[model samples]
Target: MRHILHNVYSYLTRCVFIFIGDITLNENRMLIGYARVSTDEQTLDVQLDYLLKAGCSLVFREKVSGAERDRPELNKLLKKVRRGDVVIVHRLDRLARSTKHLLEITEYLQHKKAGFRSLSEPWADTTSPAGRMILTVFAGIAEFERAQIRERTAAGREHARARGVHMGRPAKLMPSEAVLACRMVTDDGMPVAEVAARFGIHKATLYRILTRRQAMKSTDKSLNKIEKISQTYKCQLYE
Candidate 1:
């Protein structure tokens, strides 16, 4: 009985001195840090130092590109973080490639009831309400920027249309080249492929040009036949 009582007393005594609200030193939950770099030439020392000074007891480090999706250390850190524990990084860019990725990581941590913090971006601390609010502000700014970009792009396109500016890739052949290609195909009896090569145009474009010339010739012949019939009727009426 006395041994059990001594153990209880010692546990309570230590509890009284413990900072219950501080998970970084709570002895159960902890603050974990992650550091990364793109290439072997880059060093993790700077990020590691920041995380250590910020109260992280354990840190995971790796050398990998931000564009790379398979970061073993990062995956392990994400899996290892428990509820009430914090994941600290030197900066947001140190952890994620873009804002979308940053939000994804934070949302995952939030769902797990874990916290995230950036030593460089104090506003990115998810352990408190202020930091979360700051995150909201960032999201709003990103939305506003996208809206502005869309609006400006639409306006610019309208302005370009008003000025009669052509959009998309410019025509491969100019008017003179088109006329020459048609003459080569129709008059000179050159093969469409040979004309296309000589004019630096695609065979498909040459086919279109050839089709247009045939349509124009058919229309011209129809008009001439109509004119000849009208003249013959006038001569019979005079007789």
Candidate 2:
């Protein structure tokens, strides 16, 4: 009876230890932070400070344009985030410039079962129910605004086109310059490389112009030969 009691006590102690270990594992908070600066004039330090003060375990930052998609630090931060982790940002706009991009990032986090928190905006935390609703509304408004802007731009372009205004990059070489380069290569027997260097144009451009000229000449010659053959055929038939 004494040995049996001792064995039972040992088993109970082991069970308690396992239970404590599980609780400790569940209590670990995984928090990550991300910050961005649009230009050299902007500083990421202020954003990073707020994230640290808010209890972020790790932080990532980048000095890149908000319009750019391929941000190295942002990618690293996303990869490091695990399920049940929290991603903190100073503001939503700092994370992404466009509403579509913002929604995409947020949705990805949600899919990963991670939460999002904005230090400045209390209504921007995904960990709460109200915050999720607020973010959905905000995302809808942003997408609407972007669509309106795009429509206005398209209308403006159409109006300008109606007024006979040209759009897009201006021609790099004038028609006269292109014609002159073609003549130099075809009639003057100037080497394409020399012509390109002399005219301050790229060798590729020179080659393109020369090739176009050659194609035109070939087409003209083909038409002339066809006309001659037709005339001879007509004469022979009449004779």
Candidate 3:
């Protein structure tokens, strides 16, 4: 009976400690700031002031272009972020190069159970329902833009094909090289594999070239024979 009571008390104490720890962790959750400038000449004073006033405990600063995908300080901040922490940026552009990029970053933060905020754009805050709605709208717009670009590219490719433009990668073997490769295998009595290796092409590719050329020669001979027969019949009638 005493052991059962002791076990119950220990379990209750552990639950209390765990609940208290969660509260402490929540209290310690931090607001982190990120500041960036395109050039060395630009100053981060204003951004720093805003972040400090916004209660950010730490601020990551970088003098790199936001257009660059690999920002060292930004990557470090992202790595250091923890669940329940919020990452604040001076502006949306400081954090992302485009709407698609912004969505990607937010998606990553969402997966980490972190939050995001842009000081200049209230609608970009992920901590609020309204802000999340606005971001969803932005995501939809970015997706539609990507779809339109893909459609235009596909249409352009189709139009090019209709105009007899060869699509995809150019042929690896040139006309003269193909002829030489075929001859090296047939007339020179060389192994097909050896000829293909000398021509820097697969043996299968060499075989395809040979088959196509032979078919063309057969078609040409058949056409020539038909022309000769027609001429002979015309000469007999005239005689």
The most accurate candidate by TM-score is 3
What's the best-to-worst order under lDDT?
3, 1, 2
Q: Model 3: C-alpha RMSD to truth? A: 26.8
lDDT comparing candidate 1 with the true structure: 0.63
Off by over 4 Å in 3: 1-25, 40-42, 161-239
Top candidate by lDDT:
3
Per-residue lDDT of candidate 1, residues 1-239 (tens digit): 35434544553443223212233424576889999888955577878788889889999997887767667787678657776888999988888877845754665565456678888888898776678666655544544444455467668889999999776732566433454455445434556665564344556666666566556776654234323333443333323
Candidate 1 Cα outliers beyond 4 Å, as residue runs: 1-27, 40-42, 140-239
Q: In model 3, what lDDT does residue 46 have?
A: 93
Give Cα-based local distance difference scores for all models: 0.63, 0.62, 0.64
Instruction: List pairs with backbone clashes in candidate 3.
Output: none
The better candidate by lDDT, 1 or 2, is 1
> Residue by residue across 8-50, what tens digits does model 2's lDDT show?
4553343233222221113566888898888855577799789
Q: How much does candidate 2 score in TM-score?
A: 0.47
